[model samples]
Target: MKTKKLNVKSRTENLSLIRDFVSSSAAEAGVTSDVIENIILAVDEACTNIIKHAYKSYPDGELIVKTKSTRNRFIISITDYGKSFEPDAIPEPDLQKYYRQKRVGGLGMYLMKTLMDDVKYVSIPGKRNEVQLSKNLKLTQQNVR
Candidate 1:
């Protein structure tokens, strides 16, 4: 298993840097461009959510991004120390309602689920919040609709 870790402050401006790290790591695993793109987008969404929700846009919180790749899959784990929430509590997106309300946000989790083969969340009170995303090396279209 190949592994890499990035420790950076949770700031909106650092999203691009995070993307670049994911891109390079995925490329190193020989992931195709299409799959790599999806993985990148998913990671971006995860980090964005951390910055906005977990860190509450404070910009000074710590964010840890870890990557591990094998012959059959690629995995990304994002951790933060600011806040935590139950993943099951998040309702599925109501796109029509969002459109009617002119809401352009609130779809990060949905988008991450759609773009990755697996998405997992963990929160340990007084410890940290982590979101793990993985992409199978053999997936075609995503499983989620």
Candidate 2:
């Protein structure tokens, strides 16, 4: 499968671009509308985090979004050139505590992790950080619509 790459600056419009690409890719993969909505929401949250946290600290780097499709699956990789972040190290959001204190910052990553079936992260020594997400298409008769 060939991957689709999109390069955009850290701006609000790019978020929409990323969501559209991901959602369209999901539809092309024959995923149902519900699954497609999940994909869009997950991708949107990831992109928003990059804009707000990743590139927000540094105003010079561009965000990269790569979308790939297989016969029965779809993958989207978001790469940013800002400071390195360890997604694995982020502690799961304490829902109980947040429900009481109303904290922020970790919920976006939590939502992304929950919505996607597979999420992987790789940070090079001095290069950009990459987050790879994979989605498997369900083949039930009800899901084909």
Candidate 3:
């Protein structure tokens, strides 16, 4: 397995840096372009949640994003020391409801689950909150079906 890690402040401005890091790392690991895009989107969503919800937009909060890649798998682990929430508590998105309520947002979790083969969350109270997003490197968009 090959591993790479990045530590960035939990700010909206750093989301692009996170995406770039993940994108280049996945490409170097030989992940397909389609899979790489999926991984990038999932990672961006995960980090955005960490910055907005966990860190509550505090610019000083730290975000640790680590990538571990093997022949068949690419995994991104994001850690935050701010706040943690229950992943299961989030309900499946209802697009109609959002349209009716004129609400935007709340789709990051849903998007992550849709784009990644594995989406896991671990929260240790008063410790850290981690989100692990992974995809099978061997699969292409067509192979996914």
Candidate 4:
């Protein structure tokens, strides 16, 4: 397995850096373009939530992003030292209601869950919160020409 890690301030400007890292890591893992794009989007959504929600009131907090790949899978893990969030507490958005109300926000978590093969969250009170997103590279690579 191969792994890479990055640490950045919990700010919006750092999103591009995170995207680039995820893209490169996914490519290295032999993930197809479509899968790589989805992985990037999922990671971005997770990080954005960490920055905008978990670290909302603590701008100086740090976010640690880790990318790992094995023979069969690619994974991205994001950790934050801010307010922990319970993944189960976030209900699946009702798309019909969202569209009827013309809501613009509250879609990040939904996108993350839908885009990645597996999404898991772990939060330790007063310690840290970690969100893990994984994609099965074997399946994705098999689709490549």
Question: Cα-based RMSD of the predictions, in order?
Answer: 4.8, 2.9, 3.6, 2.7
Q: What is the lDDT of every predicted structure here?
A: 0.89, 0.80, 0.89, 0.87
Candidate 3 vs candidate 4: the lDDT winner is 3
Q: Which stretches of candidate 1 lie over 4 Å from their true place?
A: 139-145
Please state the error at residue 4 of candidate 1 in Å.
0.5
Candidate 1 per-residue lDDT, tens place, 57-80, comes to 998999999999976899999999
**Would you list the rank order by TM-score, best first?**
3, 1, 4, 2
Top candidate when judged by lDDT against the true structure: 1
| Candidates ranked by lDDT | 1, 3, 4, 2
TM-score of each: 0.91, 0.86, 0.93, 0.90
Q: Model 2, 50-111: lDDT tens per residue? A: 77776774545688888887766778899988767778677899989888987887898898
* Comparing 1 and 3 on TM-score, the stronger one: 3
Candidate 2 residue pairs that clash: none
Query: For candidate 2, what is the total of clashing residue pairs?
Result: 0
Looking at model 1, the pairs that clash are none
Top-TM-score structure, candidate number: 3
Estimate the overall C-alpha local distance difference test score of candidate 3: 0.89
Determine which window of 10 residues in candidate 4 has minimal summed lDDT: 136-145
